[model samples]
Target chain A: MAEEKIRVLIAKPGLDGHDRGAKVVARALRDAGMEVIYTGLRQTPEMIAEAALQEDVDVVGLSILSGAHMALLPKTVQLLREKGLDHVLVVAGGIIPDEDVPKLKEAGIAEVFGPGTSTQTIVEYIRNKVAEIRRSRKNA
Target chain B: MFDKEALEKIKERQEQWEETTLQQWLARLPERDELFRNLSDMPIARLYTPADIPDFDYLEELGFPGEYPFTRGIHATMYRGRLWTMRMFSGYGSAEETNERFKYLLKHGETGLSVAFDTPTLYGYDTDDPMAEGEFGKCGVAVSSLADMEILFDGIPLDKVTTSMTINAPAAILWAMYLVVAEKRGIPWTKIGGTIQNDILKEYIAQKEFVFPPKPSMRLIVDTFEFGAKYVPKWNTISISGYHIREAGATAVQELAFTLYDGFEYVKAGIERGLDVDEFAPRLSFFFNAHNDFFEEIAKFRAARRIWAREMRNRFGAKDPRSWWLRFHTQTAGCTLTAQQPENNIVRVAIQALAAVLGGTQSLHTNSMDEALALPSELAVRIALRTQQIIAHETGVVNTIDPLGGSYYVEYLTRKMEEAAYEYFRKIDAMGGMIAAIEKGFPQKEIADAAYRYQKEIDEKKRIIVGVNEYVSDEPITIPIHKIDPEGERRHRERLARVRRERDNERVRQCLERLRNAAQDERENLMPYILDCVRAYATLGEMMKVLREVFGEYREPIII
Candidate 1:
């Protein structure tokens, strides 16, 4: 039997309509052989969390370019945890400042990707992090 | 353009020169083994000669500027008489904040005003709405009602300087509020000139800011056309834009083709509305992107004018010469800016802005260098404004009109661009027009595929973006980021609340009722009703809610 695919959900969680980055990343992840589901434009944090739960995604990627990440990203992380998805590796991208990265990670985001990040870097990070999470969950 | 005997002699001499001189140089120093591709990924030839366009008809294809088939330019004088409008697309925080920014830009030699509304305003939401959480004044100014609109334009002369608002979806509502402002100031609607980016078709295709479905959206756009033609004659009703389409990762050819087709659809819709094409077509303007490729962008602009003029005169049967002019504004590509070496973007923007000038743009906006990191700070935006100033005053490019018009390479590239765009036109025409094509996700899918291909090229080293994929840098960004005063959002919410409370709720209710009823009827022009709603101080959200109930919202088909 083939190993289970790393299930991921790519979401755009704000009123920002700049989705060139989001769509490019989604296609890259799908091509990387992960099971990807895209939540179309203008998704709220609640909508994203609901999709995360229903889709049973192992990872959640949030993209925002409207400079609302300080308020939206943390709320998304809280919603995911409230839904008992603490194990889902939450990552964010799109115009987030470098100063906000530590704060976002402290708020339970696994990583924060800035502009010009390579898809291969993202693919490798997801593969390694998901394997580590699975091993920990199995041991637990 | 050449005599037959002369052409034969030149061709024979060129073959001999290539055989002997070119071959000798190539044997000693081989050419680089790499394909030279433009932003559109089209192959660029190493050399071009008259042989490339052997049947070139100078009068037929590129007539004198300000004449028929305006491939060279729209105006005879061009930049010699007046400079292109240096309009900066700006807005941030509250109305007060953006108003200050506008005054700043005007004082610093910005010729015109361009308003960039926040996400909420673009979506027709009030600042206090829950859906607007974390989004207040982030991307642009937050305008919830006429009170906000008043504050945004306070103390600005309405007659002297023209303004351009980058608002859609609720463009009619915002436009009504603007007209009311001018009316309060006792300025005639005909005297106040501006442009509302009322291109909703592009919203569905690339921008994703569309509210209502296509049919109702097209109806709303036609309503603006009818009203604008009658009242605000100087105002541009629709700015058919390719800027966002190119920014969303389309080739220069795709941007040119899709934008012209959208313009054609609007003409058809206006004619179907029983209005004469000449009455509304003249007011239709275009917006394009000046990307990294210099010659390709210049060729795209020239080809756009030729195709639009031919279509408006022949295909649409317009008698007026004004209707045939493809007047346009251009903005340097925002997607080309990088976060790694922020300062280098100034150089990139300078090159792009020069292309817009050479391409004969009516108005231009140069992106700030620090935009890839955040909204431009005061220092960064000044540098951006000065870039245009340098091009206009310092550089002697404005002294000549279409200086590159006769270059062998430029003419060949312009002809190729026209052919490629017509090819796309044939495909879109067969899909039963843009609306049917958009419903099938035709343009959206095309843009997505192009975007992915571009990214892959950069990732795999096939394309080189300095400071992104090549010439890597590890230095930390030290530029001062533009931070919105957090108090602005609170202040705006309070202002919105006061506007709602102080206004006569009874009158607001009645106006919205009439607007809702008018919106349900397809034949009714909703601009008059929307103007009434604005007069009663009905907030943007309140008015858009009625339309949302009447026409319903549009949900885009998932394409990625």
Candidate 2:
């Protein structure tokens, strides 16, 4: 069988118009051989989760710079779970405070990448996590 | 002058380090050689020494304050005469809400007013427009009509305080609304003073808030220049900006070069429109980002003034000294804020604001501490305004002019920046002009590459950002955050409905028809018709829709 491709949805949530970092990360993931869908700026959590469901991506990456991550991210995770998408890994990256990482992780976030985290690290993390999830499912 | 024994000791220590270095390991175990330097890599050695600026003629290069090639300072007394205008960029929710915020800012010792329009307003849409749904007052103030504009500036005298509006694409129409509001208050066109962020090239490069394509957008910008030069002589028609460029993750050098290139393109556009360089150039202003690199930011500003003066005089052939001067406003970088220990942002802003003052900025906007989280709360915004006040009042840095002028590092960086910027300018010239370069995706690629490389450096720990990768905290966000009004959109739409029902429909139709006619002809300026449309209370959406039909939308080319 051909190798299954990892699908990722990169989305910007909230009103922040700054997109340089988001665009760069989206391009990096694409270059790393993943199929990445970049939903442009000013997206709401409902719209993001809906798009992720439609795209049927293996991972959903949310980029929030407007400090609404706490308010927005949990709602997105809950929606994903309510829609029976809990298996899909949820990751985020932005100007997130280090203190908020544990809280986000507790809220069912798979990983939280802060600013200055390498694109390579993210790619590697996603690849490893996806493989581990698949391996566990096969054993089960 | 070192002693022989000390020199021998140093050499021995160096040899010991070299013996354990990676080169020694590489020789022992052969490996593929990697490229040492990248095209976008900023070199550490490009930094210092008198050798880089050996031909420095102090009087000519760093002339006295208010003289040609105004690198030292724009005015003779500078802050000694009057401190830089402390203008905080403030707006949010509907017009009435933003008007209250403006009044609050002014009451809190803010010297000037700076308006931030909502996304729909920036894109020229009425609150009732379908495309403007869910986006009326989300980002900034929603000004959909002359009624909204009047409400935004309610109780504030136009002739008293100079306002700077951060709106592009629909800049001409929004500006027309401002003029109409001023006229209603018995203020003459000549008596009004303010600046419009009318730079379109940077819109394509960074902000991505553009409406029309480059050609039609350039036409509208030139129209503002012509109108302002003839009518509002004190008004700065365009604030050639680099703030958005830096915010888009460009390096200091790229920000300086790309911004000036955009400025040159605008000057070319004005001259092509038959306006004299001296006539409209004096009214031209600049806006820049004060990033974390303190010395580099200061050097960039100095080099900008010198380069603009030289190019305006030697290239554009302007005889008036005012045409050569590059007066500018500075805003601390929003990208530098951290959501981790949000309070740490206060210190960062203070340092950046000090750099801007040292760089001789004419006006300043200090970013609030809570910006990385949301739009600044009233308390946070007040603190930001106070940061500037403390700098101007407490810090003696403003006591003298160009305090850091003779520093060896600053002088070297200034000259190096000028040389590097001119090289980029020459390349852009080769690519035709700013518009051609943008269409070809040259500047966009360069900025993207620079952004990626900088991110790499930060990841590799070559660059250290406090409260982020290093010195991290485990505390929760204890600060209060600003919340957007849930009723903002509903309220805005109701106001729009009332205006639509009450305004003279026939006059609106006639005014829009005149604007449509004026837009079709290159010979007629659109400002007069825009003012007429504003007087009729025609919505921003209606006027922009007409222009949108004539000048299609601009789609950015993806070239990463």
| Candidate with the greatest TM-score versus the true structure | 1
User: Runs in model 2 with CA error above 4 Å?
Assistant: A1-3, A11-17, A31-33, A37-57, A60-121, A132-140, B1-41, B45-52
Candidate 1 segments exceeding 4 Å error: none
Residue A61 alpha-carbon offset, candidate 1, angstroms: 0.8
Best candidate according to DockQ:
1
Candidate 1 lDDT by residue in tens digits, B1-560: 77788888889998998899998999999888567888777888778888888888999999999999988899999999999999999999999999999999999999999999999999998988899989999999999999999999999999989999999899999999999999989999999999999999999989989999988998999999999999999999999999999999999999999999999999999999999999999999999999999999999999999999999999999989899999999999999999999999999999999999999999999999999999999999999999999999999999989999989999999999999999999999999999998999999999999999999988998888999999998998888998888899889989988988999999999999999999888889999999999989999999999999999999999989
lDDT of each structure? 0.94, 0.85
Q: Among the candidates, what TM-score does chain A have in each?
A: 0.98, 0.95
Listed for each candidate, the true contacts retained, as a fraction, are 0.74, 0.21
Error of 2 at B286 (Å): 0.5
DockQ of each: 0.85, 0.23
- Candidate 1 residue lDDT tens string, A67-130: 8899899999999999999899999989988888999999999998888998888999999999
